[model samples]
Target: MDIISIIAPMILVFFGYTIGSTRIITGGNEALVERLGKYNRKLEPGLNFIVPLVEKIAIEKTTREQILDIAPQPAITKDNISVEVDAVIYWRVFDWVKAYYEVEDVEDAIGNLVITTLRSAIGRQELDETYSSRSEINKTLLEELDKATDDWGVKVLRVEVQEIKLPDSIMESLEKERAAESEKQAAIFKAEGEKQASISRAEGTVQAIEMIAQALKGQSNSKEVLKYLVAQRFVDANQKLGESNNTKIIFMNPKDVSEGVGELLEEDTHISDERIGNGSN
Candidate 1:
């Protein structure tokens, strides 16, 4: 080994070591360096330097928004309905050192935590609430997840429920219940309409009688005219009874009603002559 040969080999080694120690971290990314198998420092976006063998980039992660798709989980509601629920989580690694050191598998730990939390939340709510209160559920999940993931150096941006599936039989039963409820409401509305109409008809009948009495206010044949109006109303009432869907025993005979009205008018005997005179006119 002469001086030139030794110097040439040392120069090559230095160049190789310098090139190997340089690390380039790109946009929206970070790296965790571990010195001798212990946490040393975090590397931010852009060029970074480290000893080639003594310091290693333990983990590299994107600081930008990330998505984690949760597998479908089985849960039972308070109503005892079995359902499969799946969701997507928006999250990002805020601390690369904690994310790398604190958990064995960050993604797996988050997924399991979400699944367990969901099961617990769903178990407290009824099936109807689970379907109707999707926004509330998502809000609640986001809050819980954020709190739980704080120590893991993860920030949960949002939680979105992707799907909720129930058995076909349960769906059919819910449909039938909805239809039955609609029919019940319709029937109630119909009955109310009929009741209002009947009340209006009764009020009209009273108003008609009052108008007739007023028109014959001082007429000589007023008594006879009133008797005729009463007799007509009796016949109308009987006709409605016959038209009704209900089977009814009508107690008042139409002829008897007419006779009673006629006899009552006979008390105003002088009106009989007046009625005859008006008829002739």
Candidate 2:
């Protein structure tokens, strides 16, 4: 029994040592092995055997995509407008050794770097530009971050500007300015329309006058045409006076009316009575 007890302890110890030496790493993950507190080699995913007491696993890093959510940060624009901006970052570790050793905290480092880059980018643009040029700003930020984090064994896949908060006063003022501009444009358009209408009316009046003059010149005797035109004008005037309900009647002597009619008829005569009378005299 004493011999069996000693052999059982030895067997358990051997099994424990073997179990500790063997490591099963899953896919997309890498383990860094260190010998005597010094980096010895990188272990790929699978069953790997290491000297249990002499070799230690330094760090384990995953190669899968990682998402980092950045909190809202205060930024100043080129026009000195203060704003709060937030974003998200997509990244992955390319080299396990460098990722573990180059930076103390990878997540925090990336967060801070993003904040700084966003602030700097925002500072270079005005509030209007910042709102309009989000895509450009995001591309620049990704490129800068990728360059900065390359040494840390991280690859930035994408950077996105999620939200931007602006001051209420600026927004209100912009709206008012836009409204005023629209009103001014409308006024200018109205004035142009009036000017065009006036020009058209003047052109039409000139054309009408030219047409009337041509008609008069085409007549064989303008005197008959003038007599007919004067008669039409008198008829139109009489019709207008009759249509007015408030018109008042005026009394006239029969002799005066007869004399006026006789004068009108004599004035319309084609032959000159003055020449005939002079000949007689």
Candidate 3:
């Protein structure tokens, strides 16, 4: 019975030692071993053996990729505009030893670094540029963060600027400015159209007068032709005035218009005859 008791204790001790020393590290995870509270070596995934009582795990961390979300924070632009900005950081631990010993808290350190860098980046750009140059800002963040966290054994894969918000007053002001610009453009277009139409009408009148002069030149009844044209134009003018709702038009006798055109044509013919006589002499 004494031997049986002794053998049972031995079996328990052996099993205890074996179970305590054997560590099953899951995939995508790593652990650092320390001897006497000092960093000794890093244990890889799968079956790992450590000397119990003399060795202990200092830190265990996942090597898999991680996401760090930065909360929305206030930043000032180069134009002296205060704005809110937020971002997301994709990172993963590459060297477990450096990640554990180099920085006290990897996640916290990265987050703080991102805040500082983001502010600096925003300070270099104006408010309008901040909205348009989001891709540039994100690229700058990734480069600077990747460079800064190199020693921490952390790799910053990508950075994205989520949203940029403007103050309500600023948005309202911009909307007003855009509306004013649109109205100004519309007015200018209308004025140009009216001006073009007036020029086209003037050109048409000049062309019609030239065509009539050419047709009546060297004709025996040119004076009669002029009288007929003047009477027709006066009748057309009266017709247009009668169509209007607001015009107070005075009607003139057609015989009076014919007499006036005949007198004007006689004066013009006398002037031409005098010019020809002077040239011949």
Best by TM-score: 3
Ranking by TM-score: 3, 1, 2
User: How much lDDT does each candidate structure score?
Assistant: 0.84, 0.81, 0.87
Pull out the clashing pairs in model 1. Answer: none
TM-score of model number 1 = 0.69
**What value does the lDDT take at residue 135 in candidate 2?**
99
Clashing residue pairs in candidate 2 (N, C-alpha, C atoms within 3 angstroms):
none
Q: Would you give me the overall lDDT of model 3?
A: 0.87
Q: After best superposition, candidate 2 residue 225: deviation in angstroms?
A: 12
lDDT of 2 by residue, 198-251 (tens): 578658745653454345543566435544454554454456557656445343
267: Cα error in model 2, Å: 20
Q: Indicate whether candidate 1 or candidate 3 has the larger TM-score.
A: 3
- What CA RMSD would you report for each candidate? 6.0, 10.4, 6.1
lDDT string, candidate 1, 1-281, tens digits: 59999999899999999889999998899998999998889898898899989999987889888899998899999989999999999999898777878999888999999999888888888988998998999999999999999999999999998888897898899899999999999989977886787688779977876677667656778767776787788788667757757336366765676566456545545576689799999
Give the best candidate by lDDT: 3
Q: In model 3, what lDDT does residue 89 have?
A: 95
Give one clash count per candidate, in the order shown.
0, 0, 0
